[model samples]
Target: MVCRSVLLRSVAAAVLVASVSACSLWGGRAAKPVAAELGPNVAVLGVRQAWTARVGKIELPLELHVNGNVVTLASSDGVVAALDAKTGSDVWRAMLGEPLSTGPGSDGKTAAVVTRANALVALESGREKWRQQLPAQVFTPPLVAGGRVFVLSSDRSVAAYDGATGRRLWTQQRPGEPLVLRQAGVLLALGDTLVVGLSGRMVGMNPNTGVTQWELPLASPRGTNDVERLVELVGRVSRVGDSVCARAFQASVGCVNTARGAVAWTQVASGSEGIHGDDRAVFGTEGNGVVTAWSRVDGSRLWSMDRYKHRKLTAPLLLGRSIVFGDDSGTVHLVSRDDGAPLNRISTDGSGIAAAPAVASDTLVVVSRNGSVYGFRPD
Candidate 1:
């Protein structure tokens, strides 16, 4: 009886979190969570500020892509920038127009950005190379591989374009869901196969021919409510040796074999954001703000930290001896990577973190929701 009661309470809590959604759940469209009180800082954790820059206004949970030593960043205001990873200096900045919805996808040689006008813009060095129109609005960043750019739009289509000339290559699509979240998914190039996340599964494609290689189901839609069925792969993935690790929006987290398209293991964890890892373990935050770590080899639980319950974690990052995470309260927490205990923290701007911090070599790049970008290092 006690076990059943606990299980019922857990399911109820998950439903409550899902119903709140990303936006305003009281009425019309979805909305982001309102700014929460900063509460109290983590006192001290030995994290030192390396540099800070204002890389335009960050309204969405857009992630920063790092290629070479230049990190590509995009803002909702149509501003895209390439910053030096070591110094945090702007290598180049291009203003597209009034509003930019997604991207700043880069593979060092080329960069791609998407606008709110349903367009794909490519840049070389700092110059505009070409721009192409899409059939629908885009919610994820473009994936540049080989000589092609792979884009998954709101119309539930995965299409490829020539990065050099912006010509349409080939397109494959799935049925669009009634409701979708605007979060980005992992789009990576694995040898000859291209991995793109659709509504609830991961589809591997041929970059040259746009052919379906393999389809691996990450999360199946199995909820009674409209909000509960809104599941998709969120954030970026962790590539450990031969395994690809990822998480579903509010479902399970697992690691898959990239070459054979086989499911290794999955644990019932719920998080809207994604995950991060090292050579040994995978770390992610669940919907209730519990940071859990699992072994990369056998998916064994290492430890879990739950002090920040319900704080709305962005994503968990591993930095030196600390497992770092930024919360909706505009504070960054650092916990022991060895034991998962709270260590220290610092505040950005009291507006919450925008996305998972991008790791460039030894430095960590972070952006807050209120347009503040910061660089930090273990001190």
Candidate 2:
């Protein structure tokens, strides 16, 4: 169980989960091994904490919705609050009084939160608007867009509901995998298309009709057993210009030509966390914690940094000229974006950052497992 728990977090870092064993899973392949050692961390980048707002205990990833200067976040205790991005002061707060299964989602208008009890609660202007019971537990954060809220549930289903009325608009489901990730696929909205990362591919769906515009194959299920073929798409997908990049939980990472609905390139590296890239290069942190940079055009390897090898890390985020990511020890590392080189670091709650640090307007925001949300600036 320890090995399963450690390796499941090896790269993907499942949301707010702590225990996993073969007995807990259907007959599946055993997880890959990981060393339980961590190297000494020395601070290089100096960061000053600007402000912090009290959020109740949070175990799952912190879902942050940043629109202009307003940032919204939800705690596991079901308190959703909107804060002033620059000041980190609470502008409004709403409590659902339920154990949150997923985090908060909003469009700077209607805010959404899900309960482990399989309920969806919507709030407007810090007031309860509506609540809807679902068929299964939600695994991904609610995505509010197009007058609808989108969420992926534990039963391999995707559903849309009216953001205002909690009315189910449409529901779609794919066949369940023999072995699937405990986490749900990430969802993105571009125009009228809802781009979703699924079991083994990425699909662009029509938000209005639930029809897929196109599907891009990311990985094919393979293995002697179920666990070997658990090819869930793990985290958020990156979109720069007309290209969209995604990583398969234990398979590979690659980018696609969104305009042409064609794959640009793929390389053989296993990771669950998605890549961070701009127009020229795409960056990834592998399952072994080795970070690499590749040519976004040709998928040719440019450089690789293994300083954090074997250390559990959260998803990497490219911030300005640096790549910033946090480790299991709650230490944040900054590496040069031009080439992967150690830059600076800072320590937080020491309970770890369960999610990728988000950029809210001019501030970098992180939610620690200890229920502390800090707003900081990187120099």
Candidate 3:
């Protein structure tokens, strides 16, 4: 009887392993191997006006900024170029001595660019104002607030420098891996808090002196089993109003109280690649090809759609009453702010859109991966 029982246990274990393997085969849908098919039945708006320019002839055009009639483009070749926002005419160009990891920061009068070697170079109208070297590499764009430029370095140091003179103001260091500031780190001037998204957590710092206010861990503690490993992915944090939202791979979306440092709510999702929010809603895109929207107040899912499935999404761009997002196939989608319903769709010839579209007046400017910049106005 003991031998029979042992054999039966072994058989059950084998069956369980087989079932998991079968599920794994179909699960985790890799981005479709082939380029996505463009739908023929829908009417995509034609390009109203397209402008193409080569700035410094650099590859991997990472970040774009448009302030009034001035546009700045940062490239991997250690150069930042300013152009006319409407005509793409050259305004001025400045070359940093080292390759740039983060994009340019501007206060409409002065522009700050950080390099991989930790140098903060400030420029105005294409002329160098000052340069200062810090102790580590800066992977995140500098934030200009209250006459200071705040920079986050790969060595986990956050420092504030004089925006006009590159003078070091204050520095604070954390214990985790550094984070890249895709959009400028959220500065809540009213709360006196500066929010930064680190590797697996969201950190709140005092805006004035770079003091640690609070730190919130985002991911679950590591587990011993394979199931836990599958769920272990990095968390990304962003600020929407008084709340700081941290999203992790396969983990629940967590909203932390900016002032109290306590978790306000948590909502589960599958992937962490795309998570964005505004004053009204929280948005996330999962590996399963679903984009979901939730209420910012209570963490309730407002609406969901699979139309954006299988395509990588650009970060969500919040317009006045709508959200604009672009996918891998060069399709730009606008969804209603209230119901998440599709409002309009337009296609650009460019393949991959890396940054969120910039809006100036009534015009929307989108930069493609191939260096093609297109401007659109409502018809």
Candidate 4:
């Protein structure tokens, strides 16, 4: 009897171990995170700076807008300053309460500033035109279209007001979660529809009444709950001929049809929060340190180059025929857009180039993580 009892206990222990192993295998571990890389034949040659300026001491410089000879900057500290685009000199300054969340939207003469306090302030000649308050904080940059200024709140509500009078025109609420984990969405004005990207989905609504024109699912990775990651939609909603292009960085790039709300194609490239395109091609930096180009028509992979090892790339900036982007290590890379080949590289004195470089005609403006703005152009 004693022998029988011991044998029974051993068999039970073996069964338990087998059950645990099966659970471990079925629950699949998360995939290893890929690091950034640099492409081959890339050379680091120093470039000359045209100008540098201190905009003031702020935690984050939210937006940079260039208008004629004037450059406007909004900070997270509720300060807006207009600077001379050529000389980096101050033109005017305005102080608003609460942090400036989105960049300032302007209609040449008037500026619409969205605040973290859910207020939109209209400014002209360094004076307040009007202020309209909403129920939630504003995240994406406000769009000034059709003689109206549109502001998107965190609650997925789009509000439009008369640009000159601040008169409420329409308030359309897009279907969104009660709790949004990330700002990885865009408010784009394309023709009659206002486009917004949510978690695993994209919806186009009529700007007039806030009715859904079409809705489509953007294919994300099977297990990624992108909303929970708080990933902001960093790419612009660029209008390519009749189609619109945008990129999100949950697990891949979901290029979609703007008119039909259908995905044209999806790519496995990651860390593509910033996307820019030309007449023939689209360019962006992948999460794994690869700069790539894809055909805009069919979504075919054109060419890719790995330049650095495990360096996070900034958004792709179009400079003439070359694409420019900076990494976390203060290295700026300029690549030929024709074939995805590296052309030139420069090192900034700051810690890292976190923000996208601003290209104004012949001058390039870049901000460092250490709160310094540097301008460069070809000599």
Candidate 5:
């Protein structure tokens, strides 16, 4: 069996265990490739670190919630904080006093997170609003929008709660592939439609009633074994108006016309992370750390860059004129979105970037694995 053992860890809800001698998750039996060497820092893009702050170590996949001038982020040890994007000053800070599995998803006013003990806790301004226990383990960050808290659990369940009172509004359970990924899944709001990723399909639901509106498959499961056939849609999708494009883990990348409930196009892409883009093109980092740009309209290859290959890169973030990516070496590379040319490189705390870089109020913020939050501004 490719998936030999299943262990529940603090980082992930469940981890896939494989053999060192057989085909592993990091591609095939080939040896790991060395990261590409970064040459001289051109620093053509004039940017400087604006400020820095500290939080608890971020071990889980916490989504940095950017709302206007404020960005809300959480640590694995249950420290949730809202920081001013420009000044890096704390707007408010709250400690949950436990290890969190995922979250700190906020809608500016209310923040939410899933604890390791399966409790969905909500906070307002810096105080606990309510806490509700979930039926299954949650890996995806709870979507706090439309005055409702939406959760996508590891067992492929979608539940909604009253954002204020933690009242159970409704729960929608769907049958899925036997094995669900322990990583963060897609749960976002597309106007009135509640967009969620269940297995390899993106399903649209009614936020008020939890009724299914439409479902579009991004990738089909293939291969003989369960591990080989895992095709779950990860988080951090690219949304351009009514069009949404996402990646089905290690399977394919596709765009969905949410307005029409139709697929624009899909191409086989061997990547595990989600994608980001503008109206013209979408960008993604492959499992080998090769960055790629695809035409948004037709899914054609726009360009590709291998300078960061094998570096274990996070998802690409299209910020202003530059495409931003955080690598395993605690380096944030700013490359040209048009051709992936080196623009600038910024160093973090040498503990690796914990999540994809986010921007708010013209300030770029990235969290390190050691809980250092660095904010940068264009100079």
Candidate 6:
């Protein structure tokens, strides 16, 4: 039950969470491994709090949408606001007056979010433009790109809608296991191709017509039961040119060459969070709070850091010379991008970080579970 509770706190949106045989997740409740002690804050990497804002508590997975210098974020209570990433000032805020499941994906102009009531609402400049009813529950943030709102529902269905009007464009459904992760799945635009994560495969689709272009499996289902075989790609992928590297739940991490529509490489990884990288290495956090860096060219281990083991870390953000991660203690960790060495740590509201840290216009922003939005700038 402790393992399940930790998972629930980390990925609160997980649906139909099945029973696990062992309590070995994140060090488990049996032994309860103690977290590593932090060293003195030497201020090796200079960072200062820029601004702070408030919103409703964010219990579900919320993917911060960055368009230019504006970042759009949503809380569980359906309070969607776009803030200037630099100053943490609100560009515009909208209250949907309903509980939201996921999102606040924006294209600098239009913002979109899905409510727990199965409604997709689009806002333009903080004004409600239109709202459309969805057939299935959605956990992935709607991709607002190219004048369209794309949604990947929990039932392994992909649908598109007009950004201006709530007109349905096309819906594509794929056969998948009945159990699906309610976390944010991969849904992004690769050039003109709509790269989506279906089950454990990264499928390329034509955004205009919703036609399948190419399909590459990153992981395959292999277990006795549905929960054991569950493999879905998470978000916050590392995209360098035509190559997009993503994680297949707790199975493996792989890169797909979108241009060639072929897999570059795949390495077995027991991490459940998404990955981030630049040109050299891809970085991810394992379930036990081990941070790993893998070579981007070939899926090989570059370095692994376990200093924060059992801390329940979120996915990382590759910012400048450091990779930033948030933990269950609401502390922001900055580690060396070249080596997984600790650099610095920043404290938050003590309510724990709700999601992965995001950066826009040189400003790093992290939202806490208590809905404290803090923006930091490198000094």
Which residue pairs overlap in candidate 3's backbone?
253-267
lDDT of 5 by residue, 1-379 (tens): 2323332233343434211122456534556677888988999999999999989998887778999999999999999999999899999999889999896789999999999899999999899999999877787899999999999988788999999899999998887666776668899998999999988999999999889999999998889976667779997899999999999988899999999889999999988778999899999999988999999999999999898988888888999889998988899999999899999999998899888899999899999999999999989
What candidate 6 gets wrong by more than 4 Å, as runs, is: 1-32
Sliding window of 10 residues with minimal summed lDDT for model 5: 13-22
> How high is the lDDT of residue 289 in model 2?
80
Model 2 residue 293 distance off true place after TM-score fit, in angstroms: 1.6
| Per-residue lDDT of candidate 2, residues 135-232 (tens digit) | 87666788988789898776667889988789999998877454555554678787668888777788888898788899888788888855565677
lDDT, candidate 4, at 316: 81
TM-score of each: 0.87, 0.88, 0.75, 0.78, 0.94, 0.93
Clashing pairs in 5: none
Worst 10 residues of 6 by lDDT: 5-14
lDDT of 4: 0.64
User: How do the residues 1-379 of candidate 1 rate in per-residue lDDT, one tens digit apiece?
Assistant: 1122111211211221122244333444444434334455554566789988886777644778888777888778978888887888888888776688786788877888787777889888778899898887666888877878888776667888998999998888777344456657668888778888877787788887778888888788887855557777776788866688888878988888878778888887878788988778999988777789998777899998777776888888887777888987788888888888778887789988888877785788888877788888767
Tens digit per residue, CA lDDT, model 3, 310-367: 6777656667666677776677777766766666777776566656676764567776
Residue 42 displacement (Å), model 2? 7.4
- lDDT (10s digit) by residue, model 6, range 41-68: 7668989999999989997768888888
lDDT (CA) per prediction:
0.76, 0.77, 0.61, 0.64, 0.87, 0.87
Q: Give the 10-residue window scoring lowest on summed lDDT in candidate 2.
A: 10-19
Number of colliding residue pairs in each model: 6, 2, 1, 12, 0, 0
* TM-score of candidate 6 on Cα atoms, chains taken together: 0.93
Winner on TM-score (2 vs 5): 5
lDDT of model 5 at position 309: 86
TM-score of 1: 0.87
Instruction: Please list the residue runs of candidate 1 whose C-alpha ends up more than 4 Å from where it truly belongs after superposition.
Output: 1-45
lDDT of 3: 0.61
Q: What's model 1's overall lDDT?
A: 0.76
